[model samples]
Structure formats: C-alpha cells, structure tokens
Target: MKKKNDHGVFAAVRMAAASHRLLTVGTVLCVAASVAVSLLPPLLLARVIDRLTAGLPLSFLAVLLYFGSLALEGVLTSAQESLLVLFGQRMTHALRSEMSRKLSRLPAGTLAEQNPGEVAARFSGDVDTVEALFTSGIISMAADACRIVSIMGVIAVKNTGLALILLLVLPLFAVFTRYVQKRMLAAQLDNRRAVAAVSGQVPETLHNIRTIRALGLEDYMERRYDRCIGDSYAAMERTNFYDAVYSPVVLLLNAVVVGIVMLLSASGNAQLLTLFGMSVGTSVAVINYISRIFAPIESLGMEIQTIQSAMAGVRRIDAFLDQPERTIPPARREAARGDVEFAHVTFGYGERHVLKDFSMTVKQGEQVTLVGRTGAGKSTVFKLLLGLYQPEAGTVTIGGVKVGDITDRERRTCIGCVEQHFSRVPGTVLEQITLGDPQITGEMAKDAAALAGIDAAIRALPEGYDTVCTEGIFSQGEWQLLSIARAAAADPAVLLLDEITANLDAETRPACWRLCAVPPRAARCSLSPIASMRILAAERSRSGAGNNI
Candidate 1:
C-alpha cells in the first residue's frame, strides 16, 4: 500500500522528535543553561562599571563572579554542543535507516521512476542538510533567541524609555527580515533541486561513459553536463544575491540604532534627562545590550536560510517515503505441490495489453516447455506466474494458493527463477550462491553446485567456494553457471528460466543446457524454445532422467 504524500517537513521533524524525546529535551535544556550562563558576564561587567563610576575600589567578589561566570558558560557551551551532536547523529541515523527500509519495500519500478543519483543524493546530501539543521541551525537559533530575550530584560531594567525606543525600531527590521526570509526559502529550495539535478546527471554520464565513447558522443555528453552545471550556478547566484543584500541592510539598521542612542545620550531636556537617569555606566550597558539584540538578528537571517534548506530536503525525503510500497501479506495457505496455473488472465503495460484471456497450467512433477515468437506474451506469462505483476483480470495460482496471497518466505522456498540477466552482487562465491540465506549452508551450496555440475569449476578457483567475484575473473559461461547455481541453492521445487540462454553464444550453450537438465527429482524445470527442448531430451535420454519437457 502506498503511503500518503501529504507528509511534510514539520511532520518529519515531529517524528524524529518523538523518537528522540530524551535527547531533544536534554539538548534544549543545555542550550538554555548555556545561554543563561553566557548572559551573566555582561551583567557583571555593568556592575563593575557602576562601582567604578561611584569612585569605589572593585571588590574581589565582583571580579571572581565575572571570571567564574565566563568559565561556567564555556562548560555549558561545550555540553550543549555535545548534546546537539548526539541528537543530530541519532536523527540522521534513524532517517537513513528509514530510507533504506523504504527502498526495500518499494516496488521494482521506483528506480526507473526516480533518478538513481537523486535517490543517492537523498541518502547523503539531503540527510546531511537535515542533520545540520538539528546540530547547528536549530540549536544556535534557540540560543540566540535566549540571548536576545535576556538582553532585552536588561535594557528594560536600565531604562524603560530606551527600551521602548528599541522596541519601535525592531518591527521595521522584522518586516524587512520577513521579506528576505520568504525570498531566501524559495531561492534555497530551487538551489537544492538544481544540485540534485547536477548530481543525477554526473552518475548517468559516468555509468554510460563506455556507450558514449563507443558512439562518439563525447561532445553531446559534455554539453549536457555543462547545462546541468549552468543550472546549479544560476540557482546559487540568485541565493547569493539575496544574501549579499541582507548584510548591508542589517548594518545600516545597526548604524541607525547607534545614532539614536547617541542622540538620546547628548540631549539636555530636563524631563528627558530625568527619564534617562542614565549614567555613563548605564549608557555603556544599554549600548552593549543593543548590540546583543542585533547580533541575534544577524544570526537569525543566516539560520533562516539553513532551516529553509533543510526543510527542502525534508520535503524530498517525505515524498520518497510516501510513495507506494510493495508489501507481501501473510500466506493464507501453504503450497501442497509445485503446480502453476494462470486462468483467463489479462495483463498489460500501461495502455498496451500483453495478454488477453490467457490460460495455462503446469501440473506437479511435469516439465512444461512453452515456445512462441517474440512479443507473444511468453515472458508476461512467467511474470504473472511469479507474481511480479498483478493481472488485470483472472487469477494466477501455485499449488492451490493464489500467488498474491503467498508470503515472500513461502514463495522463495517454493520457486526459483533464472532471468536472462542476473544481478551480480559483490561477495564470495558461496555467499553469492546462497545470497546470504542463513538456512542454506556451505554444504547445501556445494551440493547444489555439484548437482549443477559447476562444483569442479568452483573448486578450481583460488579460494574454492570462498573466492571473491569481480569483473573479468569469471567468463560469461561461468557467470551463467553461477546464476544457475544460485537458483539451485534454494533447492526449490519449481524453477523458472526466462530465455536464460538468449544472450549466450553457441560455445557456452551446451554446458548451460546440461546444467538445466541436472536437477529434476521432486523438481520441475520449465524451459522455452524447440532447441532447448531438443537438448534437454537428448541429455535425459543419455542419463535415463525423468521427463525432458
């Protein structure tokens, strides 16, 4: 069942936060403690200035208080960083795990629907962006807010009139900042898509580099790559242009605030002067608080960009996680025997129907061979019998059990398939043959290998069954032999081969045919083509084996 696509960035964060509640709480507390401790030094400095203005000697207690607060703040800052890092790492790990699980659950066509490089970028780049949000962006923004609030409290206590003036100036800066933030969010999201596009293009070109070189399409590849690079550059340019304008605007606002403070300090109206009641020491404290307030504002600008970037990544991830997943339900009934049937099945690929009212049956312990011309729905029959694609009408059943109703465990245990091309995974020979199935031991693999007549060849390798597989080491014939061996390792009762020898040359065809005839006791081998049937019949006659087709 497909997940809903409505999941958003906020939902992703809430999910992460729910899972790591303790860590989230710990990080927030550390940030609060750190900000509170950091605010102490400025207050202490103001106290020292007031004492100096009173023409009194500085107390040892006052100096100790300032230095002690500095030391404590440093420790709290370290603790906060540690907590944030721990939280970020945990969240990233969970997200990566979730994506991996999602990939496994996704249907076969997801890779074709989405760019492989873009999917990979989601794993690394997008995940890192989200991690940075938790680690630095969110925590820093929170700490800055605490600092600003603490400073505002100081300003209010020092002089209400000045505090009121600062408040009036804040809204103008906020309005300008809100405008910039909206632009930045849109620009950053575009930049992220551009980066993903570039990432997708690079791997596509590299993976097919051989074909490009062979076809003499080097210039075309270069042009395509250049276009992707240009897109990324244009996106970054827009984001940078907005960022460039922000700094100057903030500096101008800061200059205006300084001018207002200076004018207030210089004024001599009796009521205003009485309202000020501010000594040189108080003026210094107020000016310091003003800088603190604007410092957070500056940080707020950058942090908003970081947050927007992360939100973009989150949205991508959410979309991925929300896509339809292929799920295997629990088996309703066990297979009593290796009997395959497709009754009046209708199937199609999009608008093109491959099969119409197709009916076929292969009884238990029988070798059923099907032969037809290309595009005659031959492969589609195998796909339906294997439950790879759901039929548009009618039903497919194996051993009295509906194919779709069978669990993956029962299906894997009952049937095996060798495609025209098998995916080669990196592993030792035995591991690759067993595909890491714990139930299939090395001895089982060897038995299957021997039955398939590939044991001698595998044993001749450098490490026998433990030899590592790499390109060029195994011949095409040997690879085909390994594919057969891997399929046989499951000891399945029903084996499906879909034009497996379609890609093989005459030199390797005989050996492949011989391997196909080796396992037939309590097992069924379904082969296609008249030549394959002839070869299997010839081998069966020579070995006194069971039915060939």
Candidate 2:
C-alpha cells in the first residue's frame, strides 16, 4: 500500500489510530463485560439441572444467584450498545475531518479524473463502510474473541479431549473466510464502477438540462440511469450470492463438527458430569462458547466486505492525489504586470495538440484581441496566461516572468477570467458580483453590474441585491453580464474575457464591447473574443477573409 510520501496508506492508518483514546478504552471495557455476562446463562442452566436431579430442596439462595447474573448480563449488554455508538461517531468525525483536509490540500483537476457521483458517495457510502470497520471489525470481533478464549479455558481445563476437537475447527473457519473473500473481491469492484458511472451522468443532465427539455431527452436520461441501476443490481446480486453460498456451507461445517463431538461424548464412556478439571456446568459453557465464535466468523465476512469497499475508496483517492499536476521549471517567479508574450508555445492535453506553437506578444498597456474559429485554441491562450495549462515547448511570460514560474497565489491574484459558461451563484445578485471580497462593497458591485447592462435585471428580483437565485435560471445574457461583474470585482492586473458578449442583446453589444476593451489598472492583456465589431476594428483587420471571428 505504500507508494510515495504523497500516496501513504500509513497516513490513513495513523488517522484511524490517533483519532480518539477514550472511545477505545470504553469499547474494550464494554466488550469484556458483555462477553463475561453472556457466558453466565449456560452455567446458570447447568446449575438448575444438576440441583434438580439431585432431589435437593430448592433453595432461595440458588434462585437469587441465577437471577442476579441474568440482571447483570442485561445491564452490561445495554452499556455495550451505548459504547459502540460512541465509537462509531468518533471514528466518523475523524474520518470526515481528515477527508476534508485532504480535499483542501489537493490542487484543481483532482475531481476531473473521478466521476461526480463517486465523489459524492465518499461522504455517504464510503464513510458508512468505515463505520462498519469500527463497529463490527473492532468491537464485535473483540467481544467474540473474549468469549471464545474464556469458554475454551472452561472446557479445556475441565475436559481436554472434547475441547481439543472444538479448538481444531478454528483453522477451518479462517480458511473458509479467506476463500469467500477471494470469490467476492472482483464483484465488489464491479459494483463500485457501476456506481461511479451513474454519478458521472448526473452533471451532464444538469448542464445540458435545457437541450434535454427542448428535445425531450428526459426519457433518454432516465433510460440511461435505469441501465446503470440495473448494472449495479447485477453486481450486488453476485456479491449476495457469494454470501448466501458462504453462510450455508459454514453452518453445515459447524453442525458437523459439534455433532461428532456430542456423539463421542455420549458413546465413548466419557463422564458428562465434568470436563477435565471443571464441572458439567463449565462443559456446557464451552458449548455456548462455540456458538458465539461462529457469529464473529460470520460477522467477519461483512467486515471484510466493508473493508474491501474502504480499501477501494482509499485506492481511488490515492490515485487521484498521486497524479502529478502540470509542472514548470523549479525557479518560478511572481507576476509583476501583464506584459504578455507567447513564444512559439505548443501544448496538448494528451495526443491532440490544442495550441500548435502559438506565438503572440502584447506590449505593456497594449490591448490586443485574439479572434479565431470556434475551436481554434483562442481560449487556450487565456488558460495558458492564467497558469491553468503549461506549454509543451517554448514559453509564455508576463512582464518578463515566465507564466510557469509564477506562484499560484500571485497568479490567481494577478489575472481575472470570465468563462463563457459561467453559472449564476445562489444568494443575492450582489453575491454573484462580489463573491465575498471584503473590499468589493455593495456600491462598487452595483457600479460594475450597471456597466454590464444588468443593473435593471438584478433590481427586478424580489430582494434585489439579496434575492437567492440557485441552479440554472439565468439567461445566457444574464450570465455574461454576471461574469463581467465578477471579473471587475477581482480588480485583476490581467483580464481574460471569453465570448462574454455573444449572448447579450443586439443593443447591449457596443456597451459590452467597450467595457471589456477598456484597460483595468496597469493591466495589459490579449483580449480573445469570438466576434465583436469593436475588437475587430481595434485588434484585428484583414483585407481578404478578415479575422476568423
């Protein structure tokens, strides 16, 4: 499980080990007490049988001792349950906190490689499995082990021969559990994959909800979801079958072992009144012990299942975190001002090159425009400038500092980007602009929103600045304006505007064009656009086909 420092499974194990101490001590005590009390019933029954057969008058002291043991057992069982709950809650709290911390430390693109549904399931489904690890794996097994040993001591110390036969069967139990796990592992992984496939589909339906509504694709999405669900069911059924087969076989084996031992005791002329040095009551106690041991062995199967699920989650999280982000030369620097230059920079995600040795230079304070075909890597230029993507060959620099060299904090603070598909955030319209920037007070937000021709539209909301608008209700034009408002709030040194004017109304185009074209602070950038008369006249012009936009 150990890979690099970044892929440390020891970190996760240490997480489990160090979470809480009181819960562990409490659970151990709880298990010990419960196990001790449970063994009492068999002894009490043996006492009543022995006493009655002897024709001795029933004594009040005997009745009192039996009833008192029963009452103690009842009380201890309740305490055990309470402590188990505490153990589960504490373990979950630690797990969730660690998971959240790990998530925060990971860089962007971590979730890009994973399905959305699978990510969501980590908190819900993955944590549930972890809970089982603490409950069944820890507490249940501990109590079962205590019962097995204590009862074995009773039987072996009293009658060595009968106890020997029972003790021999434990290896068979271990072998059987191992075999069941081997059979179930592959089916478990298949179930997890089917779950992730469903999660990946949810965002597609949400993002393209309008297209689905217009073309009546709701039924199509439902069918797709149904198919994923069916696959998941098939995988679960396989896992269930493994369990169903395992349980019956184990039970049959257990019955055979105990039946042969009982037959030998009855026919071999061995004394039933005592086992080794212990009384008949203790021999019966050993029989009770065997029954308790089988339950943990059975329960261990489920714990193994939960463990397999948790291990799979750990592997996925490890894979996602271990993947190296795009790297740059070791000596990187801070962005001073956006004196941008792209020198024959070539880049690609994988296989397909998006930017083919792209070259462009914008002098300090110069506002240039990139106009190109729909898929002509125009936006790719801005992604490079913002330090989101690195070039494969050559360099992209800002104010003499290589874009690759810029520290993440400085890079984000220096550049502002407004994507074409910006989503309207929940809360008031002001939130869509300010995004909780302490310096971007209410008045500055309105000024920026007004400049983008969205002030009136924002004012029409019931709470105006405070009205909550969640999900996908904003028109494309409204989203464009909101993007502009957000860009201005950052007060960035370099601005990136991607098709912000495409969805605007005809009359609003000119104002929107000027708002983007005007320089912010000493910020100088190459303005990329799909189409705009202002950008075309100011940034690009050709006698033949003109700019591609």
Best by lDDT: 1
Expressed as tens digits, the lDDT of each residue in 446-510 for candidate 2 is: 87677556789888877887878665546777878788767755445566777665667676666
Query: What are the lDDT figures for the candidates, one per model?
Result: 0.75, 0.66
Number of backbone collisions per candidate: 0, 8
TM-score for each candidate, following the candidate numbering: 0.88, 0.83
Report the lDDT tens digits of candidate 1 across residue range 25-76: 8888889888788677777888889899899999999999989998998999
Tell me the spans in candidate 2 whose CA falls farther than 4 Å from its real position. Answer: 1-13, 16-19, 56-65, 213-223, 268-283, 324-335, 404-413, 471-473, 510-549
| Model 1 misplacement above 4 A | 1-22, 274-277, 369-377, 510-549
